[model samples]
Target: MSGIEIIRLPSRFDYSFHRQFGDLYTPLIEGGECDDIILDFSQVEYLDSSALGMMVLLQKKSSVNNIKVKIKGARGATDEILKMANMQKIFEFI
Candidate 1:
């Protein structure tokens, strides 16, 4: 509803960050104070399926709230994994 909310993801993005991730975005989305959400993967080096699943879940929640979600700073194996998962179909990389 106002500006973008940028959430900086942890270096090792996995199921461990699931609850924290949700806590970070849920309030912003529910508050309806932002039109867009940017997930910063700049610090991330490795990620697992659970991380990918978390992203998909975010996308679903964001879409329902009419909020745009984008991923940024993905590189190396992390980037490749995301591409392999066809995450581009669900999230726009920046």
Candidate 2:
């Protein structure tokens, strides 16, 4: 099933992640095409609740579809946010 699709967001993750999440993530989840999803946060500097909410939504949707959502390259404030949300347990971080 190719596991997961890699979607790269812009460098300014704090500003653009929400938009990108909606534009890129919604269709992928709704399509029910893959069992795993990976979001590359290498370029992301920060993440807020909105981003966290999106992640939760994605994970929940994926769970229902029997998919796994993994996150990679998260650093700085972005990483902190994920930790604060306790999303590391839900997502495989790399």
Candidate 3:
């Protein structure tokens, strides 16, 4: 927890995964034990608005806990979506 927690997203990162997404990061953020959280987008093929919202919420939660968040392995359309959403302001790309 003091190091980093990598949450690997799924192929379809949308509303369907909202609950699962929260389950992945909620405890880590709330525990205040982790120093960094890496969202591994390696398997993500698509992400809708809901996914964007989730990311925003996650950032808000982690920031309050002084935890860092980063994104990695985003390519093609997924990367484009993130940029269009101005995710760079909230998440560091690794």
Which is the leading candidate under TM-score?
Answer: 1
Cα miss at 59, model 1 (Å)? 0.6
Q: TM-score for each prediction?
A: 0.97, 0.81, 0.96
How would you encode candidate 3's per-residue C-alpha lDDT over 1-94 as one tens digit per residue?
A: 5779999999999999999999999989888789999999999999999999999999998988899999999999999999999999889999
Worst lDDT window (10 residues) for model 1? 27-36
lDDT of model 2, residue 68: 84
The local lDDT score (0 to 100) that residue 6 gets in candidate 2 is 85
Candidate 1 structure quality by residue, lDDT tens digits, 42-81:
9999899999989999899999989999999999998999
Higher-scoring candidate on TM-score, 1 or 3: 1
Q: Relative to the true structure, how large is the alpha-carbon lDDT of every model? A: 0.93, 0.78, 0.94
TM-score of 2: 0.81
Candidate 1 lDDT (Cα, whole model)? 0.93
Which runs in model 1 stand beyond 4 Å of their true positions? none
Kindly report which residue stretches of model 2 are placed more than 4 angstroms away from their true locations once superposed: 14-19
lDDT per residue (tens digit) for residues 1-94 in model 2: 4457887866665535677677787777778778778889898876667777777777887788787889988888778878888898889997
